[model samples]
Target chain A: MARIIQCVPNFSEGRNKEIIEKIVEEVRIMEEVKLLDYSMDKDHNRTVVTFIGEPEKVILAAFNACKVASELIDMKNHTGEHPRMGATDVIPIIPISDVTMDECVQLSKELGERIGKELNIPVFLYEKSAQTSLRENLADVRRGQYEGMAEKLKDEMWKPDFGPANLNERAGVTAVGARMPLVAFNVNLGTDDINVAKNIAKGVRASSGGFKYCKALGIEIKERNIVQVSMNMVDYTKTPLYRVFDVIEREAKRYGVNVVGSEVVGLLPMAALIDVADYYLRLESFDHSQILEKRMFE
Target chain B: MARIIQCVPNFSEGRNKEIIEKIVEEVRIMEEVKLLDYSMDKDHNRTVVTFIGEPEKVILAAFNACKVASELIDMKNHTGEHPRMGATDVIPIIPISDVTMDECVQLSKELGERIGKELNIPVFLYEKSAQTSLRENLADVRRGQYEGMAEKLKDEMWKPDFGPANLNERAGVTAVGARMPLVAFNVNLGTDDINVAKNIAKGVRASSGGFKYCKALGIEIKERNIVQVSMNMVDYTKTPLYRVFDVIEREAKRYGVNVVGSEVVGLLPMAALIDVADYYLRLESFDHSQILEKRMFE
Candidate 1:
């Protein structure tokens, strides 16, 4: 079985269309990689590029994109509403199929070493690839952003995981790690009762001690006169969308609100939907491998 | 988007492994066609081969397999528990994605014409591709099986939609048509009472005035000491597995029987599972195209 992995690399410069296209083109031209999506947010001044393929090919595509970003984007003059870290802000590698986080963590470290050694840029390992518990969270690793990174790295506890301890002013710092894919899903209610949405969100999100992998919020869709319980299911395998949606539907009944519908905001691993089918259809001995398209890939 | 269609061709003579492999290999080597599954039932003396690809490629592959089966399997020596009418008993073309039943019917007719013209094999169109309402059902088309087919063909009302009016003795007659993918699913009950299973089966099957596309029967599993409602969800799109299961769950409750479990036997189109997810999750604007594996093909 091939080691399929997904790489979503965030770059700091989103305002420049040419630069974003150039970086994205690197992934598109890779022989085995499929360029799933790439979006630029002018407000955040950041671009997110998503692609997937075999581990070697995916890592190659990710490295090429990082190289392009380092050449074109200068963090010294970069400005964005989102967190700032590197020209290639953060590259997170996720295991899609026939691969594990342990393999991804090893891949991430090797990728970090290559970027640090070859590109001569500082790199930090966060999430599953973190060397210490303190560096496990991305926010903690990117605490001071690009400006304070030079001073922050001078401290013993904050030493760079790979590459030079001193910051590379032009390329800035990059954080690479292994993590599970996240699903951005939202369920909309018929009524505009924001309290109903907020209450349901409170019951399902991790902050309030709900599903460990769930992060939810209440948002108003003003034009539609409806409220939505938007969520980020960090690990769908652990917290399936159907389970959470059913809970929200039952909870909405409590507030006299009916769940009208829901949306899967972006591309999701096929296994997530397969799990939903198994739950709803009460399928026995069902496997994702049984899907025809999946068999074609094999 | 790719015009994906599934072809399931049933052939006579399942006892010979070499002949079955030879026939199945015709579909295997076709460009762009995926040989999903092929199984032989010695008791039925039949080999059912399943494959999928674009409409044109699929038809071509089906033609090649039919030609091979016609050469290898002699209907004169064929014997099975299942009904049979030809060397290639039946060829069903089903729309999987970005294709319609109308398009599949057209493909079936075109393929039928070619097979009858080139292979010199008699062809009858049934189901969606049938020329008359009387020939709409496959059982109606294969009324007398192989032995009685020759005499039946002489009747004016029983003329085949394509091919010669007389049957070919060695090659026999074939029924080809366009139909939706069928899912052989079964729901088991905890109790051993056969009556409960039969009543629930009647409440949910098409013959009993339930779902229009579902055909079901209650069968006993002696070893397990349980009864099951086995079903053929012929058109999963029109009457999905989840809806039928829910009805069965409710009906089972009335009899104080719980739906212990369910099983999806054989290959089912990926859309069937996607529909289950859409219904259970109450997704808004959810499309099967959103699946990552589907996009890879596109």
Candidate 2:
């Protein structure tokens, strides 16, 4: 089986179409890399570009995109609701198939070093690629956003993992890491009362004492005239999609509301869906090897 | 996306290990062709080889295997539990992914014509590749088997779709067709009471006015100490695996017997399992395109 890794890089510039296109073009131009999706959130002023390929090709494509981001984006002048640290905010490599997390972590570190040395960007390895336990969480590594970053770097523990011990004035710093594939899923409700959606979201998200890896929010989709429970399943392997959906459905019924429909916003790992299949079918000894298309991928 | 077609060719030789190996080797060595499985049923004296690849490669590999089967086995001397017509009895091309049934039908015709013209084998196109309404069923095409094929072919309605109107005494006749992916699935019952299994099988099979595309049987698995409702889901898209399993489960409950477990005998299309997920999760607006591994397969 071929080693497949996915790279999702978030860039600071979202509203500027031309800049966003230029940054995304790096991934598109890479021979083996597939630019699965790239979307700009004007409100957040951030763009997330998702792509996948062999580890080497993916790292190269990601590095090229980071270089483009560094050249075009100015972190000092950037403003967004989401947390930020650099022109290219964060680049996480996720092992998609036949690739071990250790290998992806190694790839992430190498990619981080290359970006730091060649592009002269300050790098911090977070998540699975973090060198210290204290840096394991991305939020901890990125605690001080761009403006606060210059002062935070002066601390002994906050020394940059690579490149200069200081942040680049214009390009700023970047967080490079390895992570599990996250599924962005949303389910619409029949009720216009956003409280039901909010209550359900709170009951299903990780922080609110629910599923371990689910992060959720209640949002009003005015155009649809309905409320939605938007979620990011951080680790679908642990907290299954079906369980979360089932809870939301059950919670909706308590408020005398029915689930209108549900949708996955972006690509999701196939194994997550296969888990649901195994659960419902009560299949004994079912394997992905039974999937003809899976062998074709290898 | 690459167009994938699966070809499962059945040979009349099974007990002869050397001969079965030679026949399957043709597909094993073909470039871009994946020989997923090849098994010999000694009781039936038949060998079935399953392989998949691009349409052209699969057809070429299947044709090569058929050539090997024709040269090694003589139909008149062949004796087996299973019905037979030729050394290579039947070849069915099934669309796996990114390929349509119409395209598979076209491929089947091309393969049938090539086999007829090159090997001097009388080819009857059955199922979706049938030239007439009367030829659409495989059992109808091979009604007489090898013993009576010579006289059957002489009749106007029984004229072969390709090759000479007369059957070759040594090789007999071959049935070629395009078909949907078939899942060889069996569900075991907690009770060894064969009658309960038999009755449940009748209620779950098409012949007994159950699911439209399901063919089923009840058999005792002596070694396993249980009875099984064995099924061949002819068209998973038309008659999904989960729906049939639900029926069998419900039927088994009526007999006060529980479903012990279920298994898929060989490779199955991924979409078949995904359909189960969609049903149980009650996922709306779900698309196969959202599957990351599916994109990798393409």
Name the best candidate (by TM-score). 1
lDDT of each: 0.89, 0.89
Worst 10 residues of 1 chain A by lDDT: A289-298
Per-residue C-alpha lDDT of model 1 across residues B1-298, encoded as one tens digit per residue: 2568989999997799999999999998998788988889999999899888878999999999999998998898888999999999999999987789999999999999998988888899999999889988998888799989889989999887777878888889999999998889999898999999999899899897999999999999899899999999999889998899999999999989898888888677778888888888888888777766555557
Residue B106, model 2: lDDT of 93
lDDT of 1 by residue, A20-46 (tens): 999999999998688988889998999
In model 2 chain A, where is the ten-residue run with the lowest total lDDT? Answer: A289-298
Name the lDDT value of residue A52 in candidate 1: 83
What is candidate 2's lDDT per residue for B45-150, written digit by digit as tens?
8999988888899999999999988899998889989988999899999998878899999998998998899999999999999989999988888888999999
Clashing pairs in 2: none
Candidate 1 chain B least-lDDT 10 residues? B289-298
